[model samples]
Target: MLNWSAKRPVIAAVAAILALSACGSGDDSGATGKKDSDGVITVKLGVVGPKTGPASLYYKYMDQNFETFSDDFEEKYKVRFEIIGEDDQASPEETARAVSRLINEEAVHAILGPPLSGNALQVADVIQKSQIPWLLAGPNADEAINYDIQPNWAFQTNFTNQQIMEILGTRLFADNNKVGIVYSADGFGQSNLDHLKSWAKENGKKLTAEESLQPGSSDANAIIKRFKSAGVDSVFMGITQGADTATVTRAIEQAGYEPKTIMTTGTILTNYKTIAEPSQWENIQIVDPRNFLEGGDKEILDAVQEATGEAPAIPTNNISTYAMLDIYAQAVAEVGDANDREAVRKAMEDIETVHIGSLTIEKPFTTTDHKLYDDDPANWLTYGFDEKFNLKLLGTAEECLEKGC
Candidate 1:
């Protein structure tokens, strides 16, 4: 059984997603793409992230991971991946512009994301008209659904922010009451607030307080005082990586408020610990997707870890980025032709199971849906490290993955 409910978090907006159902083959203006010659299957994937912004360091790490991706695909598929990565500076406007350049100018077969939907929200029209399959992974605010552009070839790997709230609701069922939320007051933070409120009401849970911080602001003493007054023993935060997570944690400590636990989104999990103080990370829990490369399961990842000198992946955004590369490669192998959209689309539609040695997902993509998980990874776990740097799984991590929930 599918087990979906009407109250489930939205994927696309009700209206726009409804319009997508009416997206018959209408009048279309498309890109006249150049063919890859010389018997090499030359393909391009448009990758946009904060390559030069606050998250630039981890984006550089993502670039390095792409290198391993391109190299591995070349060895396996006998193709060359011309990665046209654009630095959006983590700005939504700039990310939209970058996607335009990548698809219209660079002529990539697909477009990836800004690792945050607030930044990547405006480019769906271009991708849809181009008839290029967009394998997106990023922020999950349902902005993509309401972005007024639904590409027939679009699919998202990351879950919506509401789904993260669902994960936290399940966690609140055990050992805790009252979650204090610290959000960034932007679109991303606001949607998360919506999710948190809805979850609290549906589950008979109490919200201690909700704190909305301005984007890029560091002060949280006032908000911390509110949490203290409410006696919030646990925290639920939604913001991208940077001063947001660190400042929130610092303010909690400064205000003399100690939470029993904390739950954060993919935003913080992407680049949090690397930039935050090591002490701030103690006992903090963030949700994560499975990035199998970090484990000792495959030689490809081992080589990558050796070459990059980074820990491959502790299972987060890097893992999804790597998997997106595989989906593209496998699609091309299945049905990509030099000048045909139908073939490439069919290959992507036909993706069943992708078992790369040990890294795998259950049932994969089909014609009707594009998401990877039965429930999103945000539905799976609240994973983070303890004061001793040992990982702690607060929710359904081990149960869903190893024990087959």
Candidate 2:
């Protein structure tokens, strides 16, 4: 491991830390008429996310799987991929723009993601209006479905906020205690916070204190102080990037508030070490649902390392992006034609299994079953960090799933 401490100058902030968080694709020129011969094939797809931001670096990790999926699908199925286009600089406005470009201009039938939940809300609205069935691999905004703005055409791999609470709250019970919450004032953060709160309350836990930080305040000390004042025993934190884990950890220290644990839905475990001294890491916990690939999962891992020429830190959201691309490719192949938009959607919806890396979509998406992992929390795994930033397996979600707050 590179010694960041010795090499660490007294810089104001980590260059990586300054990178934005919370949140991309290509064009096939022959896409218009490149239909499969025996049957219609060749799929056009739109991938949207913030590529240029604090979290822009994540594009690198996600893009690798996208490329690999594209190539492998094309080779194995003899199906051509009109896969095209990427929008990384995030904005629901930009996401809508990307969707318009994909549906109207690029003519893609299905869309992979607009990574952030809030961004997904915007893009999902546009696609649903177009009557395009989109299977989402990112964003867990419960309101998207509940608000009535989202159509049956829009779906995700997991449950609503109530399900998250049903699963995590049971394991994360706080007897007679109200839950603590913190998030960015941004729409995405608030969306996640809202769901967690609703679920927390249904389980008898009140939202004790709610606080927000100004956008771009990577250091969470100030916010932690406010949550401390609120006397929260546990935290429902919402942040864009996994790197923010360190900042939240530091903020908790600043506030002198260390609860029994911290839970972040949709948050990755890659950056848990950044928030404080290494020894304090055990105090932090993550409800991540996958086995991390530090140096494991030789095929994809080695390929990713080779693609980068070295091992770049894998973003917390990296697996979803990888899995999304793979799932898309599998759907196209299973349908035997990438040309049919609804067919592609149907195939994607029918993703009942996957054979990749350490993770598996044991019970993947289906027309009837949109939920990815089984409602069984055992399918989800918890994770943490070792002395370095390597991912360490904590336990299975089954071990912690519960009903009350």
Candidate 3:
């Protein structure tokens, strides 16, 4: 369970502060899709994410790319783009308010993200009622669209939990069926656990042990002990926070149990080299959308560095956000009118088999299925660190299944 004692007050304080700033000295006319007098179309885009809370680092990488995308889009299409960002502080309630302000106050042509699954769930109704084209760039939860929300207008850039677990299960079941899981006691973790359960059932594997912990929790010795007692051959981790990943890895080492460990993205942090012992870091795999060794999208990286004066050290989220924006831009260019949200939605749905950045999608969006990549192993890959502590691509999703890593 989440420790809400300290975070609740912080969320409330940030919400109050953002509400004042959002409502201060702005045109309340909710006008959208306006063309400038100079024949340059103005597209207002809304970005909602936690810029101040525990998950701030992930959103901060996303936030930095907005200006870069805005400038590039304007230069390419001769259209003026305006970005309206709202800090949700990782609160679901605040996400609702932020999305509301974007739709009813700023009147954005398209919305970017809420980042967290809980926040996305809170604003699903508002997004459906408003009929705004929303691109969920974070929180790989497949149920976000199935919660009585309209999937026609909602789209996701990240791989869903099912897709992630399928690849993981295929790879793990090939080598060892005895598995243990340690997940965060939150929505993201729950989604992962649910998907892993489904995958295990379908693949005829049984979990030997399962455990959960709150994010930022340092007490992982008990969970590690449980896994050790279970005598599992492989351990699957669903924790998303960097600190939690470090804590758990340390505990595993302290328990003197070294099993083939598989972790989800966001677990591999730069600080892990310092937090975890060198021996414990070996034989660990991270499943992620981007292969860091591939050096994603040099053009986008250059533009971001030029705009921000510093490029992100880890450019996975940066590239992913850019790809999402690129898709939106393609739809906008084809629709020719930034104000027609319905038309843009149609254009997005009509897109089939296009390569944006280093990733490729086939029939990326549809009315019923908002998920871009479902059961497509090529969309994800496994990565592990080499002896020099540099990221090395283990294999593609297909390779990992065909030949166990």
Candidate 4:
């Protein structure tokens, strides 16, 4: 086991060596990266995401990890990945174009990202038709993946909105709490609203108010006052950007009204803490599949920070990307041929478990289910932040509800 207390130095040293080894130039000649005579199978992977657009901040550590950890993964799995990145500009239209190009022009063996749920949906059909393994490390909307589709090519490494909402709804709607939602007026927020409404309806909970906030909005005082007027004791935020989340929090603080439960998605763990006041962060709770708290997965977090000299802005996505690569690499190794796309896809489906750094995921993917994390409370961690902006573990969703943290 890669325990933080025992093997910190060893992991750091290994990551450093790997970083040094991957300093060489890469071949971007659009080759298939077929198995060479040296017994090394090269996997050409198409990476689609917003590399230079507004949502580019979400993938800061993705390309960095790919560059820094190439040697480490290749050494173990005997698979060298030739990464081809496509900038989708965080747009559905751009995502369609990028996916098409990767399928036709690049001829990549596998595809990863187009991180937004809306973007993923835009190209889901075409990518599935291409028969390439689609590695979803970011988007969380349940609709982004369709397990009913035969030979399901999409594999989600991130927890879906349904999974997080189940945990959030249980806590937020408990004790006859009057809940209100403030979601961004975008696809991400729309998905959040859809899931929230579904959970509420199934559980017979009533929402006090539902407000939509546009991205880059500077003020949310009106929304805050509306919630207050509607007697909303709990607030569920589905905003996409951390800055927008901060704006809402700032408004709540300025209004001098504190909700009992201020629950939200992993956006709180993003740049929200940096921009929001410490007081505004009070009563906030977030449910995430990967525990980025101090006592959880510190080894990988430390290793990535050590190698890249920067902490991951979106730790969940960063960690998911790391695990996704490990799972994909293992699939390729099991098939023993990266060129055989169908075989690799099947291998990915049958992978029972994988341990990357300090995280061990059992049943990462199976034939019937393609999601890496489910709605199990045991697989999710609930956390609150301290005034100092450090993650304070409340516990698992079950434990947190039973005993206050």
Candidate 5:
């Protein structure tokens, strides 16, 4: 083994090289497509996310969908796709390096990934400067982009914090009920809390209690006890992981505090069912752009199961990936050249309507609006869980707000 003194020079030299390379000029074409004599265009795409980490579950089934759906996409659009994946481990530092390598070395036409809001924030400016099409399938912070900037290169397939809070706020604040929140002390949770506060201010309401939980915390009894003391009638969770949400759920059951409503985002649908008892999930509800219960996305879900011989571990994210790829393929075809990053970006913004599987999006994109789903309560769906933790459709957000589901 090398001595510490001997290793110092080598480590410093490698760091210098990486720093210089990151600042160096790369291919100006920006992952241009190449056409072969057979009249086929090949586009290279870079995928960034945690392949192995505490958060790896968020990336599950993404790669499989890429493989299972490629042939069909190629047949329809006459364009072939080539994917280059980089494992960021869901760390901001690793995410920065992975994004740099993808943009500077991999030369990808577009990039998707770094599901967490914090990781996404780490590379936002560099990606925007690179002028690459950024397909945001995760990370819902409204601050992800400076909205004042025109001709934005990034587009969001995930709902923003503001959009989700708009729907949840109406239900949680109905009948002037006292509300309490328990959020993870992380970027995702912080953003959700900030939006919730804004929603309350705009609507002239007040939250009775607020608490923060660290990731992987094993207990939330104190948080639950505080909510009880505050006489909170509704409980809203802005936690990042399903397991953490389970901790809160278990605490609520143990303390025998029955809030009028228990609500959270789709993150609860990740692993809460497996970690918490069926009874703990009794009155829990969540709002999402897509419905997972009763197979609202049955057509694509069934196809993926048949192709892979198993169901997606997280059906909502898998279907989001499917929709994102479809939109990317459509843009490439519309531009007639994936090599022209600017053209492809513009094409993506102009897509008015897109239908895939059982999901149909109207005006999915526009020059000024990049979010796949807007803040219209009508566009959001509400869901509850059954005794077996299966998704049960509640109603549209508008209907659910006016009348209990």
Candidate 6:
């Protein structure tokens, strides 16, 4: 592995050699000058996310691994890639502007992320007009598909809110009939609440209590009190912020209520230990895409650590980013032209199954569906803490989907 931080001289030398190699005896007439007489094609790929905002850590992991991953991919597929990264600062308007720059200015063949749901929605029009293949690493809401705003060229690597809530509801409802819900007032929280409602109705169960708290609010005592009053046996949390989930957990404990509690994804696994008391976390179940500490591909984990000098707290986010690039590389190699965006889009649509390291994606991309792992329960995992406060994988979403509680 090339440690760019410690071995700058080696990286500089490699870059010099690659630059000389790219200057082949060919007429440089195009904007990107990507075509060479030797038939070696170079394509630019853009990545957009919150690299400097509150969620910068997630993008930092992806940025660190991109160079090494692209290098290896080029060596294996014989197609050169020039990766470009942009920071949206977690703003939707900035995301749209960044997309324009990537497509019209940088001439990137494909793009990854814009992490947040609202940011992805803001750029849907730009992506559709450019026909550039866009892979979203976050924004697990279904509004992208439900509103028909997501273009045919875009694909979501994360599980949608509907998929996650359905699985969680099914599992919780199996043993408890009096289920209460506490959600944020934002789009993501509301979306999960709506899905849970549908799942409850389908399972012939009624929501004992429901509470909606505004984003960034710290007062959760009322919500907890309401659930307690309703004699709820189980409490489902739809809060997106980690601190908020922690706040609610604290309230639940303060109220001296010990009902089975479940939390949604995006609750930073690393921060949970500090956010809530050990006893509070012990009774909490987390619905997540993958376990960060014990559930990722070893090889990919090593690569990320080597690049970032730290292990990712949420391995699935980084893994999904890596998977998206791998899929793009596969399409470029199969299409035989990195610059032909149309051919690459079609190639991705035709892909049935792909294995990147230890992670497997079966028919993840298709013509009608842009959501990867939407109905595939294997892609989602449930996690809980042991008696000793150590995290453990409970089961896959497939169990809940196949046999609802």
**Residue range 1-405, candidate 4, lDDT tens digits:** 432232233433433333233222234432345556766677777888777766777655566665446665666676766666677778889889988887787677888887788788888888888788999988887887777788888888888888888888878887889999999887789898999999999988777799999888999999999999989999999988888999999999999988888988887666787688888887788888676755435556776676667777677787778778888888888887777888888888888776667567787667778888888787678888888878887788878767744
Q: What TM-score does candidate 2 reach?
A: 0.78
The sequence of per-residue lDDT tens digits that candidate 3 reaches over residues 1-405 is 111122222323332333324333234332235545554555666778877867776666665565445445444454544556788988888888888888887767888888777678788777878888888877677877763654367778777788888778876655665788888887778888888888899878888888998877977999989888888778888876666777887888888887765555544552355556666667778776665554444555555666557655235556667667767776777777887888888888787654444446677666677666667677667777776666778788777767766
Question: What C-alpha root-mean-square deviation, in Å, does candidate 5 show against the real structure?
Answer: 9.5
The best-first sequence of candidates by TM-score reads: 4, 5, 3, 6, 2, 1
Extract clashing residue pairs from model 3.
none
User: Please, what are the lDDT tens digits per residue for candidate 6 over residues 267-325?
Assistant: 44534555567777776766666545553344666666765466654565666666666
lDDT (tens digit, per residue) of candidate 2 on 1-405: 111121222221211121112111234334442444655455555566667767554455445444333344444444444444465476678778877877786667677676667777776556777766565655666655433542256656434444565566655555555567667666557866776677766766667777775555677777777777766777766665556656776667766677766776545443444545875555555565455544323445555555444453454345555555566666776766555556666666666766455445565654454555444677567666677745566667775444321
Stretches of candidate 4 above 4 Å error?
1-33, 294-296
**Candidate 3 error regions (>4 Å):** 1-32, 147-151, 266-274, 295-314, 352-355, 358-362
The pairs that clash in candidate 1 are: 233-260
For candidate 5, the per-residue lDDT at 143 reads 78
* Model 6 CA deviation exceeding 4 Å by range: 1-40, 146-151, 288-298, 374-380, 387-390, 397-405
Give the CA lDDT, 0 to 100, for residue 320 in model 2. 54
For all predicted structures, in order, the TM-scores are: 0.78, 0.78, 0.85, 0.90, 0.89, 0.82
The residue-level lDDT of candidate 1 at 208 comes to 71
Each model's total of backbone clashes: 1, 23, 0, 0, 2, 1
Report the Cα lDDT for residue 74, model 4.
64
- Better lDDT candidate (1, 4): 4
| Model 1, runs deviating above 4 Å | 1-39, 145-151, 173-176, 204-206, 269-271, 274-279, 291-303, 311-315, 376-379, 388-405
